[model samples]
Target: MMYIRTNQLLKAVILLLFAVFLFLLHETGEIARFINPQYVHLSQIASILFLFLFFIQVPRMFTNSEDDLCGCGLWGCSHGEEGRFAMKHVISYGLISLPLMIGFLFPFKDFGAAEALKRGVQYQVSQREARDEASLEKNVQELLEQSALVLHRDNFVSSLRALMAYPTRFVGKPILLEGFIIEDCQDEKVTVITRFLVTHCVADSHAAGFILEHEDSLGGREEQWLQVMGVLDVKQHGGVLLPVIRVIEWEEIEPPANPYVYP
Candidate 1:
């Protein structure tokens, strides 16, 4: 009869499954939802490492009792006894397998208004002093030169920061932006156009948006995606000055495939 090490087999299977899960994430382009694209090459390297470990484990699964014995020559080998059931082993394996199960079972979901609310929407730009005043002035100058500003994922963070930092400079300038709508609890009449900014991963994502004001009622439109063309203005909120968008022409739009803005 051929003796097979069950624990070695389990380890090999798990390592291979992890590689497959990561590969699938990249294949389907869903990896962007989890981590920054700059780190994607590192993730690919990890998947390769797991695959290599899986191959190394294959030989151990068919090892005989003598092969399992260590050079220390103890009374009984501590290595090949993983077939025995133990609470600690079960818990360890279960914990290790939990992320794999989740990756395979659940569908990827983009961060939404509920998540933004929980994280607390950042209506104003950070008050940190600019490290490069010359560079900052140059970027702001380029934006000011534009007749109309259009916000896209690539330039969303920098452009929005410039506008928010100098709201007085951008007042009455035509701007086009797209994001999911979120209603403010304190003011039912006003709604926020929100986008999540991801630094490294979804865990570190933070909501950034502008308060929207319209002549027509904006209520009952919460969580819907919209393309808004409006004029930029400033408003006082919570005793702080923040940028506001006075809607001129707006239309309902489908949510973008890549929703998060990367900084």
Candidate 2:
């Protein structure tokens, strides 16, 4: 009888955690954009509910004298037969939940959410267009100026795909990118990391690629925007050559209005 009740209590806690996780994920961007000012009241109400359950469950768990809190069937809960409460469960739950809570905070805002990835590229294209407005006035000047026409969004995506699909060393090809200083590890070199953005949302972003030869500016503050001019170059690391956009000349720039790029 003690074991069955404890099992039910544990199931309730798990279900609560799962529901909260789903609720927050679904709310993603709108989590901050609360439409109702009274939502703060809603949050407080939810907090009260959690605290009420916690207060009850914790004491109950502490007082439990079950012979099988974990279970005793195919999944034997008999790891401990003692009537005394075990903090092992508490510690285990905390360790497990902490990371999952952190998971709720990803793909990280460093790169604007995945939507930003598409927008940043478009924004860049737009800025390029704005900067070139005067060239359209000059017929001969237009011929000399190689504007990065939106050839196609897919065309730009293909270049990114090439880098992703071919992670090996590459020789320099014409490349243009803008980002801020992550930290320059460059010595006689100018090693720096420009973000290769892949994001699902602003919360959970991943970064890729580095210009080691350009480590000269690697130690700059995190997330400083830079416009890099380079060619594709391949470097061998850990027995594999990975392609990198080799730096030619890099200049600092103001960050775009929308600052993330997604794959």
**Model 1: per-residue Cα lDDT over 91-172, one tens digit each:** 9889999999988998878899899888888876665625555656777899999999999999998887787777788999
Give each model a TM-score.
0.91, 0.40
What lDDT tens digits, residue by residue, belong to model 2 across residues 105-185? 655343422333344222011244335444423422332244431212223333444443343423534567665554332
Give the Cα lDDT of each candidate.
0.83, 0.46
TM-score, predicted candidate 2 vs. hidden true structure = 0.40
**Once superposed on the true structure, which residue ranges of model 1 sit more than 4 Å away at CA?**
65-80, 128-132, 186-189
Model 2 residue 83 CA deviation in Å: 6.5
Q: Which of the numbered candidates is closest to the native, going by highest TM-score?
A: 1
User: Worst ten-residue run, lDDT, model 1?
Assistant: 69-78
